[model samples]
Structures are given as C-alpha cells and as structure tokens.
Target: MELSRRGFMKAAGAGVAATSLGAMGFGGAEAAVIAHVRPMKLASTTETRNTCTYCSVACGIIMYSKGDVRKGERAELVHVEGDADHPTNLGTLCPKGAALKDFVRAETRLRQPMHRRPGSDRFEPISWDAALDRIARLMKDDRDANFLASNADGVPVNRWATTGMLAASATTNETAWATFKVAKTLGIVGFDNQARV
Candidate 1:
C-alpha cells in the first residue's frame, strides 16, 4: 500500500532516530560490534627485496621494516612479504617463502659446527677451521685407501679411487669454485653446483 505523506514522513523520522541512536551507542550498536569484532595491533613499516633460499622456486621476497627499535633510527625488517613484481611469484609466496625473514633471524640458528662424541649427552662447539681440516684429512685418507688407478680392462686411469668427483649446490660462487678445485685435486669426476640450475 502507498504510504501517505504524513506516514512516510513519520517512517523517515523513525529511521533517522534509530541511526542516530546507533551512532551514539544508545542502541545495541556497541554490542553488535563486540560480537563481530576483535582488537588489533598495527605495524608501521615498508618493503625491500631479497632472494629466496628455501626451495628451487627462488621466488623474490619483500622485507617490511616495522616499528622503530632504536632511539633515533627507524625500525629494521619488522616483517617480510612477497614481491608482486617478481616474475617468479607474481606477488605471491608459499608459506615457507613468506616466513623467510623469521627463519633467517631465528635464535636457534646453528652459527658453528657442533660435535658430540658417541653416547654423549651434549654437543661441543668447534671452530670452522678445525672442522674443515678434519673433513679434509678424512677424505684424503678414504681416497688413499680406495685408490683405483685402473679401469675395468686394467688400463691406467688417473681417476680417484671412488667416483672421483664431488658435487654440491647451496653455496656462493667463490665457495663453489673452491670446492670444485678441492674435488679436482682429489680426482673427483662428478661435480655439481647449485648455480647450475
């Protein structure tokens, strides 16, 4: 049924009154908000780019520097985000990639080699030099024991006693090159570098 002019005016006035009451908290607006709301803390920050080390995906990541931590300086890397402009991710990242910053700064990072004697309850830290020397010595001894100077037909072969090559990735260029040199000295035939792919 068509509302008379006076009736329409009355209805409009009622609607306005209800809205005002809700705005002023005279109605149950606050209760409605509380039922559907939760408190939130905000961060002030920005972004930057860094490579991904996790899988082979190598999606680009953006780091967000948040809340000021220093007396006069701005916050540093308070968060990490995905780089949308990166061709690989198109501005998206998997869970692992997204949390890259946290993983990098984790307190449990292994900063040094830890050695634990058999049956020992704890691990003792060791210097990198010592570790490298020990590994070199062990590898040398193994090669010496396995020296295979001949092929299947007994022809002279200069190859190492074993496969005669070492291969690995997950290292910087210089380090990988150094590793290649060491492997060559030991007559290693198989070689691989992470940078290959």
Candidate 2:
C-alpha cells in the first residue's frame, strides 16, 4: 500500500484510462474481474466465548467451530481468536494463546492421562479412574510417611512436606478457592499455581 509519488501518478493515470474505457462501454472484462467476494470460512462457523488458559491473565477468547453436536454430530474446532469486547486482554493474545490451535492439533498432544511403570521404556495411556486412584494412593502413602505432627521445639504442627499440589491457572475464582481449601485441609505446604509461576 506504500505508493511513491511516481507510483501514485502511474496508478492515477491507469485509473483514469480504465474509467474512460468503462464509460465507452468496454466494461465487461472489468465486471468479470471484480466479481463479488464469497463469504469466508468464518462466516460459516459458530462462535463461542471462552477464556485463554495459558496463564492467569484470563484473557477472553472467541472459539470458532464447525459442526453441531446437538443431533449426534461431532463438533470440530476450526479457529480461535481474542475477544475484542473482553476487558482483560482487549483482543490481544500471548504467543501461547495465539498458537492454541497448534496445541489442539498437535500430533503429540495428550488427550488422556499417561502412565509409565518403573523400568518401562514406553508410556501407555490409562483411564482417568486408574490415574486418580494411583495418584491418591501415592499421595496418601507419602503423607503418612512424611507428615510432621510437631517440630523439634514440640510446638504442634500439622504439615505434609513430601508432596506438592499445583492448581491449573484457568480455573474460576470459586474453583481456585476450593482448591486452596482442599490443599490446606490436606496439610500440603508446597501448594502453588501455574499462573503464579
């Protein structure tokens, strides 16, 4: 779009000539070349509001998807972009948020929990129940083993130092509060959040 003075004059002269030709009934070719633009893919997709989960900024996002899931159809995500009306980010996204499509479509992306046994060379996907049970068993064992009831000074203290808990950054305020309460109730002393990092 950067037009120098000479380029501008040339463009203007061409415009004049083209208009003069059109006025003389030589406009068929021009009409064919300037046909109406077709509606884009976005116009055919559905829009849904969401929040970016890469961090705690809670940037609003608009998700575009094709296919309706209401009638036994699977919905496929087509695109994602910042929500201009959102107050947090104002239509801007960080590199991670902008590349969420790549994350969603990545070949190595994990859609389920994966577990690898000791000495095993490969990891295998496991059911959500199995994963949760294993995690709870391990955490219970660690807490029972390392939880300190009191310090050397004999002051009462109930703290578990062997395990840590990290909450996702994309949670709502109520979820975060509940997570914090659960961590505290479990005597977790190393609780943190990915967003804070």
Candidate 3:
C-alpha cells in the first residue's frame, strides 16, 4: 500500500511528524511553543519602570513586584525591552542591556561587605565601619609616602604623585564622584583613569 504525505506523517509518531515538518521548514509543535511564549505576562503586582545600566544609552525596564516593599513579596521581571518614551533609547535595547535584570536579581550578589587584610590569601566578613577605617588608613599612608607636590625640577607644582589617583574606566558617575572626593581629601590630585583624554 502506498502512503500519501499526510498518511505517512499520521503513521509516524507526533514527534517524527514535528521533526519532518521542521526539516521541510514548516510550522509545527516547536513553532507553537515559540509562538505561545509571550514576553509580557499579567503579573500580580505593579511594575516599576527604570533604565538599564549596561551603557550610556540607558534602556527602559519594567520591574514587577507582587507584594509590599518591606515584606519582600514575590517579584518577577518579564521583559527588558527599550522604552518608547525614553529619549536615549527609543524602544530598543541591545542584548547586554536586555540581560540587566538577570544580573541585578541574581542570587550570587554579595549580601554584605568583605575585607582581606594586607598579604592575606582570602577575604573575610567584616563590618562596614571596619572596612572604611582600614581603607582610610591605607589611603593616608600611601598618600603621605608617595605624594609629590612638585615636578622633577621642583618648580613648586600643584600636582600630586602619579600613583595618587588610581582610577579605572568601568566606574559609574556616582562611584567616581565618591572615589574622587576621597582621593582629593588625601591630597591625591594626580588623576589618571581609563576614560582619561
């Protein structure tokens, strides 16, 4: 007996039919799965609109929360698409920007501050006060020892030591401001950073 295309598929298992349809570049159960998985969902709580932090072009984000803020109720973020109302990113987001929610809401985030003593092999839990105090002391010592208030010919220049301002490019504006303020307080005016002109 000869089998037609539909008869052949019906004889085979649904899985085989699905595979054959895919091979022929046709829609099947797999396509149905993709179509059903919508980006937006009717979450229980309201959404808080925010911006993505991956690049200078901040994209809009909707943070879904289910319960009271203090009680810590269930929250799930659905989509990270760009906000149409945003001036910088008009309803468009790059792959990295779209993955911001995963990064922020990950369980691997540091719960508390940590500190590793000088020449120590590992970081240990420490209070914020202790960590800040240790950092202040280290900064003071380094500034006093390496600070240079003049050029090579000692022309009474206002420049600090080259190693004074240890800056990196990945810092945000708020972080940079705090670091700069601390460095300046220690008379560390020699600024060199990843974003240096």
Candidate 4:
C-alpha cells in the first residue's frame, strides 16, 4: 500500500488528466466538439520583418498582422516576436523590445503635434503645418541670435550653440548620414543620436 514519490506523482498526474479530460467532455459523443475548436489567433496572420527601435542593437522582429486589406479592412498588428534568423539578436529581445507591442497600442501615444505656449500649464493639439512653421521660426530666431561667426581668437568657425539635434536610432544608415550632413551644414555641433544616449 506504500507509494514512492515517483509512484505518487504518476498517480496524481493521471488523476489530474482524468479530471481535465472529463471536464473537457472528451467521451465518444463529445470528441467531435473538441475537434471543432478554432485554431490559434496568429496562425493565419501575415508576418512582416522589422527591427526594434528602442536602441542601436536593432534586434530583428517578426510582426504579425491580421485582416484582409483588399476588403476595406486595414491590417492590424496582432503579435510580435524576435526573429530567429537574424544574426544580431538570434531570437532574443530585451525587455523594451519585448514590450514594443504595448508601446504601439498605448492609449497615451501622441497622434499629432502638441504645443504648450510659454507660461501655459496645458498643451493643445496643433496642426502639422503650424507645428513645423513654429519650429522653423524658433530655430531661425535662435540661430540668428546666438550664431557665433568667430571665436575670441578670431577663428572663423560658424556655429549655432542654442539648438541641438538628436536623431532616432531606428533610422536607416543612409537617412542617418543625410541627417548628419544637414546638421553639420547648419553648424549644429551638439548633434547626437538616440543610440548613443
């Protein structure tokens, strides 16, 4: 009558399996019911390859999108995971990369430009054109005011000290290079990238 640990585990497993099978109604008549169950949600989804944008690591990701776009339904992202074939990450993601879906679907994500006037306590949504115009005006004004054409030693170095540009790490190499060129042309010495930070 004495049961060893191995024997007890086997008996417990059998009992649990029996109970689960009973609850699932896996008998002859109910076997058909279980066969009619739907497949996994991501099984039929379309997959796209992408890279994580949080940092410079650029971990590859497989993004799953559902819905038929031809039927006036836009494809919605359903799932994301690290790409096993990628040489950089090798099917692994950091915490930030793993939670990228949440970031994309977050309710607090900004959909449009917002402006908070000086001495104002609240930010109001603004049009893209208005935002761009405001930014250009501010930059122009700051550059005109703080632009140093030469140092005290009479060195001809044109530089803008009031403004800096921080580029995103998700940008392609070509795009980043172009951005850097533009920043250098504008005499922005305080330029950096999100990856470095």
lDDT of 4 at 42: 82
Model 2 backbone overlap count: 0
Span of 10 residues, lowest total lDDT, candidate 2:
30-39
**What is the C-alpha lDDT profile of model 3 across 49-153, one tens digit per residue?**
776755544456556555565667555555455577766667777888778768767898675789877899998999889888987787767767777677789
Put the candidates in TM-score order, highest first. Answer: 2, 4, 3, 1
lDDT tens digits, residue span 79-146, model 1: 77777888888878888887777887789988799888789999999999988998788777877887
- Every model: Cα RMSD to truth: 10.4, 8.8, 11.8, 9.1
Write down the TM-score of every candidate. Answer: 0.50, 0.72, 0.53, 0.69
Query: Highest TM-score: which candidate?
Result: 2
Query: Candidate 1, residue 168: CA error in Å?
Result: 5.8
lDDT (C-alpha, whole model) for all candidates:
0.73, 0.89, 0.68, 0.89
TM-score of 2: 0.72
**Candidate 1 vs 2: which has more lDDT:** 2
For lDDT, candidate 2 versus 3, the one ahead is: 2
lDDT by residue for model 2 (1-197), tens: 69899999999999999999997768997677557656687998889998886888889999998888877777778899999999888999999999887777789888899999999999999999999999999998999999998999999799998899888888678988999999999999999999887
Off by over 4 Å in 1: 1-49, 62-77, 83-87, 156-185, 189-197
